[model samples]
Target: MLNRANKLKLRDLRLIKAIAETGQLALAAERLAMTQPAASRMVSGIEQSIGAPVFERHPKGMTPTAVGKILARNAAGLLKGMDQTLADVQSAITGQSGAVRVGAVTGAAVGFVVPAIQKLKKTASGADIHVDVAPSDVLVEGLLGGEYDFVLSRIPAGTDPRQFQVRRGRVEVIRFLVRRDHPLAGPGPLKTADLAGWEWVAQGLRTPLRQAIEEAFVSRGIPLPDEIVNTSSLLVMFAYLGSTDAIAPTSREVAELVAPTSGASQLAALDLEDPIIINPYYHLISMKNQSLSPIAMQLHDLVYAALSGES
Candidate 1:
């Protein structure tokens, strides 16, 4: 009897569910596309296997016994789960549902990736997307370590270019940010030389942003700031600027994003005598041989289109 109970099939569950819903063997058989005689045989088999009478054969229709009700309830739940599982699988195949992990530098995250994600969500609402914003080196490491599906960053100088596929993105313009009440904030045409005396907030040495700032000062025959607070955290940078007269350099995109027109911003961009533009450094990159999931590929294409000004 135990072996017989273990042998119950999905079709058996469906037949029981149909019978419970319709409350008549003839009607259940019609719904299942089987003859009444065949349905009766299946019912007999189920009752025999479980060693119980599942239903009472009344003159008008069938009524479920206590055991039958239990089976019917469980069958409905199981069938509903099965149907949902099938739907999820179909959604995944169509690129409408899945997970995508993207890495980007802060500037690109603000200017490009954020907008692309907004558009993607409107169409593929079931797609799960994660965006990581960091410096170029960190983004590249995440891409290589399988932590990100793709990254918007430059390949580090010494790494093999052949290890990944790349599409060149736009150049980034760097702007100096200071507290709204800082001495330089009232600017009429301030040269790089004028910024030499104050304290400065900057990234660590050898990073691209740091290198750009150093070149900007050295090219103008000006000395670097006397005191420097080295950090990569934007929170720390903003906090430091809020209380002191220090200057922080950030991409124009990030500067504009954080400093809104509402005038509530604690930081404001310094209108420099000369604009500092970083070379076209960052790119849309992924491992050469790795294939992205359907959903990840969809998002990757969306970012690519945004880079090309197609979207």
Candidate 2:
């Protein structure tokens, strides 16, 4: 019986994978930055231990035997699992596991995510969280790939949830924003034409809400300003709004970051009569590893409770 210690390990699996990938011993060695002799030795060592000639020599290049093909297939799965293990370890040591790695679209971070973390801290004192703020599509990808334990994003209008294991949480409003002193802050009816001259800070043009809004302006033959901003940075946008006459539109939950100081409301949120509903926020989670640590579970509950309080 072959002792487990002498059996194929990560190194052997890597050698086989490299050989399969490059299709030649000399080239595989070059790809791995090792000498041809070293590569040959590795292949021989594996063959001796496994008691099978794993590869066939041909004029064109090397090819795996039938048994070698089976080994390679199994090796791929093993290597993938090993890679996941290493990544999980790194993420946890760097503060990402045994806890929730939550992702949110840009709008939710400053106001909703930060405050929600604070609230979760009060109860789940020992839990850890790693938060990522990104565009909706990116965060959803992370959530689906198991890189994120949970995620927060609005369901874009006309979005099909079929590809995701979605959990609808709650609906929320988004509105246009301007510095309180801006000319339209106390306004009655300001149309797209009012925003023609000044550079406007907006979500990416590809985003559903932003795209739809821009389409409306274009359809009306209103010439958009020369300036276009594409950052999901709320604080930066808020600062710009505070400094100049720029206006930003975002979610109500996200807009909570703008609590005015000194009895001066530095910002005022506006509802668009022809406004677009940014999206409906949901508690998005990965389909993989349905098993979550106690802490991860607790964090999810806290966020759910906080949103529930609003209803």
Candidate 3:
């Protein structure tokens, strides 16, 4: 029932977050440089404003109520924004360097963003580049919520397409990869059915590649084999493939770039011949409504140029 008129104050939000984190009024108050009584009053005011209790006062300390947890999460986001804004303002006024927060999918992070960032470091010596590699959903959500400046990911789905400005990047070729000595690594024409028995190292269930794999099996009337492992970490995937006989469906560009260099020299593509038909392209995505900073713009151009050849 809360609205603009009843919005919580910055101090109240901070106090709530502190209380949630510390689990004790005295500790939270001390951290905030306020008396315990004042901190208690602030929590009361917040609870009353929201027409619900925000915490459970326990004998040990305190625990956030469901409503309290929701508010605390939003408070964290708001505080992060405030902190970034202050830093940005200082950077602009003092001609000091600022940071570019970038989120990217595994393929793009490996294939383009990481290299572009390395090159950018030589040119923009003072700027900071922070990169996060996650699934497209996580990256897209962070980009839309202001947690990221931009994302190198698939064209975000389930939203208004026009709300985003997207630059075409590399098209990822879905490759079925395995260790060099895997049972299916011999000199014979590989068949899709040949992959039926081996355990799989899969991406998360909701990811685009995973979904495509699921559909491919369903269309062929084959139930997916029991996945031995599910993860998004490229390193873990490589390590697992190197040590085990698990098959991994991965982007061709990433597999090629990582296999030879990651000390997993025996890792190689299964000659499956037929490529997994999935939309494997990377896009440099940012909000249509948000304007990019000079540094961010420069980095964006670098990523686009680096990835354009593969599109």
Candidate 4:
């Protein structure tokens, strides 16, 4: 019996993908620059190696079987990875002036990372920037796994600080936001008690930011609101805050940038009479011992400077 891993080859995977995409053996064979008989033999070999029928043949075309679908999906991933590898090698040959992969938390993505990339592009037009916006914990995981060149987000608790080169930036003060027309919106500073009557939109319970907000309520002696909308999506939170009188706690930068662009532009930050004192600093983190590509290093510096308020 042939082992799955040992029998699989790059050319075979490519042929599988081409067959699945074209649906006709003749078309797929033409694309691969092979004779139809040779393509048929190749498909037969793959099926024999796997001990299963990979496709269902009909008069018009072919359809992938369940096993075939799984193989095709994996083939696509493998091909993509190979393409990225080739691109990276080419970038190395060209002296590191290519793609720079970066990840960031929501606040940094909007307030810092995007702006920095825009500025970098003016001079380094040859650079390709890919940015992922995710929660701090998720971004940190990507940084540690070598999926990202670096990340503009805070390191999670319990992570070994020695594993990363961390550059800490300004603390982002949390802001409580509500619609401009909300009943609690007024000239006088608003108290937590004033918000007790309204519903709230909150991040997922497991998130650090949500835990801090809950802590703030406990410290203020306000019974945590039982009525809450829990979600990780900022769009959903802002939509609820704008359309309804729901209150939410977020970074000041997020509240400022999202409110105007969200179409429901009536959202405004509240002046809390007793403000929540949760300020999480942003950190630019890269792998500890690994040297970054020159392009990636330049992009990292740009992001750090922007977040740190340096020229």
Candidate 5:
């Protein structure tokens, strides 16, 4: 029985999959470009190899038996894996047709990762690129968890930086944002003290951005804003800003990305007397010893080159 099963061919599995999909031998045969009589003979041979009936023939069509369903399911997986193998081989040969997953903080997602993706797609159209934009901690976690081929983000505080192969990117200058029509949106440059009285849209208390803002206020001998909405979602922050007189602190890149020049933006960055820059900038990070697949490496190099200004 083992020897007979070992003799089953790819053609047999494909026929089984087609038969399961179409439900009729004649339809399956047409789909596979085989004659109906040839399909029947092949099905007979398959059943013989399994030593069990794989399908039950009815008046209208055929239905897969329990064994047939299992075989068809496995065949589908095998066929998909075979297709991906071919694609990977083509990618290795031509530098196209592979997938890469990247994680980045929102600022880097807009400033760097986006441009690199655009450039890569223009040349390697068959390459599949995925991007996740979140906070630095989230991006770092994704990078370490094997969810990303590489990430553009900071190593979270207290995390051992030596665990990753890091390439320092750019420092992110913080900016305060408000709706274009807010009271603070007028022409005069304001101090950090001026912002302390307003309702603020901020991330969680423990997030680096939030902590930085708090530290800035503390350093300048100003009380923290008494009313704060804590959230990490940009959409929520935008919605709050649109409806109320609230200030949002964000990276300068994000402020620029959402400014009126980029699109139909209702947000404007506040002109500050002193800039509040986060000390830890984002970096291009990948696992220390793990090598990326060829396609992922291609994108990794493209992003790294953009960071280094070589591209």
Candidate 6:
């Protein structure tokens, strides 16, 4: 019997990579210069070899199911290394060496990493960098897997600072929000009872941000309203905050940027009138036997610099 890892062929891996990048099968096939049928067969063979279909075709042409997305993402990393040795690809051509791979916390993407990418573009132009926005837990695991050179996260309080080479940084603050047209969007400072009546668009419970949110309600002796809408999609939450009376609380910076663009943000951040605060968002890294590519180092400095002015 072939070992599972040995079963995947180069073609299968390439197909998965293409599909992942294009977000559909036909587009991947076109990019690969293969017939759609051939592409489909290749994917099928891969699935059969692995004992599971890598993609599910839908109205969208193809969408990676949860497992498929992860496998595809992993496959790209594997392929990135292989292309250099065999074909001398540009990614490998430019580097001829290692590059920076970072896993950033969700909040850090726009507020920290994005600006860092800008800085890196100017200073370490030759250094290749890859960043993905993921929750803190996923990032920690990726760091252990050698998938991430470094990470930024909002870890639990008193969590071992040495565990992931924690970098001390301040937290990003967040608050409750509602559409500009919501009844409570008016100027009065938010009373705890005012929140009890509405549904909440909450953050990932796995995050400290959510914990702070829950604590805020609890501190007021208010029961979390039954209409809790939990999600990690900031865009979705922003859209809801703009279009409906839905209450979506978000990071102060993200809220400020979108609030003007969003009908709700123009309203107000409810003053729960409490001293509660979210956990600090810290940068986690692997310091043991660790080094960053020039680009990665630039990104690291830029991350701190960008957020230096921010909370």
What are the runs in model 4 whose C-alpha is more than 4 Å off? 1-97, 260-264
lDDT of each: 0.87, 0.70, 0.80, 0.81, 0.86, 0.70
1 against 5, candidate with superior lDDT: 1
Q: Which ten residues in a row have the lowest lDDT in candidate 5?
A: 256-265
By lDDT: ranked, best first: 1, 5, 4, 3, 2, 6
Measured on C-alpha atoms, candidate 4 has an lDDT of 0.81
Better model by TM-score: candidate 2 vs candidate 6:
6
Number of backbone-clashing residue pairs for each candidate, in the order shown:
0, 0, 1, 0, 0, 0
In model 4, the clashing pairs are none
> TM-score of each candidate?
0.87, 0.57, 0.63, 0.65, 0.69, 0.60
> Residue-wise lDDT of candidate 4 within 217-272, one digit each (tens)?
78778788878998878879877887887888887678778554336557777767
Please name the candidate that would achieve the greatest lDDT relative to the true structure. 1
Distance from true position, residue 215, model 5, in Å?
1.1
Candidate 5 pairs with clashing backbones:
none
lDDT of 3 at 293: 78
Scored by lDDT, model 3 comes in at: 0.80
* Model 6 Cα lDDT, one tens digit per residue, 171-245: 667766777678887665666677786877878675677777778778778888777778888777766677767
Clashing pairs in 2: none
Per-candidate Cα RMSD to the true structure, in Å, reads 2.8, 15.4, 15.9, 12.5, 7.9, 17.3
Q: Candidate 4: deviation at residue 88, Å?
A: 12
- Candidate 5 per-residue C-alpha lDDT over 1-311 given as tens digits, one digit per residue, 9 for 90 to 100: 66877878989999999999999999999999999999999999999999988999999899999999999999999988988898778876676767889998877787778888888788788887889888888888888889999998888888889889998886567888899888888776798888978999988887767888889899999999889999888899999999999999987777888874446668888857887777666789999999888778878888889877787
